[model samples]
Target: MSDLRDLYQELILDHTKRPRNFGQLATANRKAEGFNPLCGDRVTVHLELDGDTVREIHFEGSGCAISTASASLMTEAIKGLRVEDARALFEQVHKLVTGASGPNGGGPSLGKLVVLAGVRDYPIRVKCASLPWHTLCAALSGGDETVTTE
Candidate 1:
């Protein structure tokens, strides 16, 4: 329990137990749906953007601990960041969880997201860590409710 996992244990567990943005945002102007057919983890992300910044976010999903926790953290992380920054953060998580580290050790900007790096050790769980990012991209791009991931 002395590892970085210890540092983020509360963070990840809290998110999983009471996942943030875990509902449908009534005010969302953009929304996207994501599903992991392999694991049957499904979610719909609702986003409210104030120009380039995300003013609010919400989601509803059925997934494993990793997916739920990642979504919770993703919502909190992108609160005030610009769209570009959020996109960068998504890429960071993707690389980190997939074991293909990005430049600068793969997450210089996303501090706690690094906690999920252990997800790389489990290939199946990697998708759980990435679901939110895919949904985020769909929402940002004004896509209709239909996006999928592995």
Candidate 2:
């Protein structure tokens, strides 16, 4: 499993060094901002919907490598999905990172997101890694401006 661990590390580093969909949508239908005070990670997710489908998704923020990369990958994952599907993704990802249902509960299927699972071993980093997903949930939930750990 050492090889797999290295692979996961590489994946996380890649996402951090070169984030995907890291920008802002000119006309976003939905938007949300999240802050992880534990690690001082902050981010904003913006989405443009085209007939219930996310035609565009983007992000702008400053955070740890894990947080930034997570947001970057999140934008890519949810771009083509509907709002509801995106919401489901948020819950799925939340459980994945928190190990709420135990290891491999739902994280292994999260693609690059699974790389972040190692973060569970580090309690403080858990909030860092989860920042993006929290922002996403807030963005999609509507009628909410903030979703915090506090």
Clashing pairs in 2: none
Model 2 lDDT tens row, 8-75? 48778788899888888888888888987666678988878788788888998898877887888888
Put down candidate 1 lDDT per residue, 59-132, tens digits, no spaces.
Answer: 88888888888998888888788899889888878888887894344746778777777777677678888988
Per-residue error for 8 in candidate 2, Å, reads 7.1
Which residue runs does candidate 1 get wrong by more than 4 Å?
1-8, 102-105
Q: Ten-residue segment with the worst summed lDDT in candidate 2?
A: 2-11
On lDDT, the candidate that comes out on top is 1
At residue 39, what lDDT does model 1 achieve? 84
The lDDT, on a scale of 0 to 1, for candidate 1 is: 0.83
- Relative to the true structure, how large is the alpha-carbon lDDT of every model? 0.83, 0.78
Off by over 4 Å in 2: 1-8, 105-109
Per-prediction TM-score to the true structure, in the order listed: 0.88, 0.86
Residue 51 CA displacement from its true place in model 2, Å:
3.0
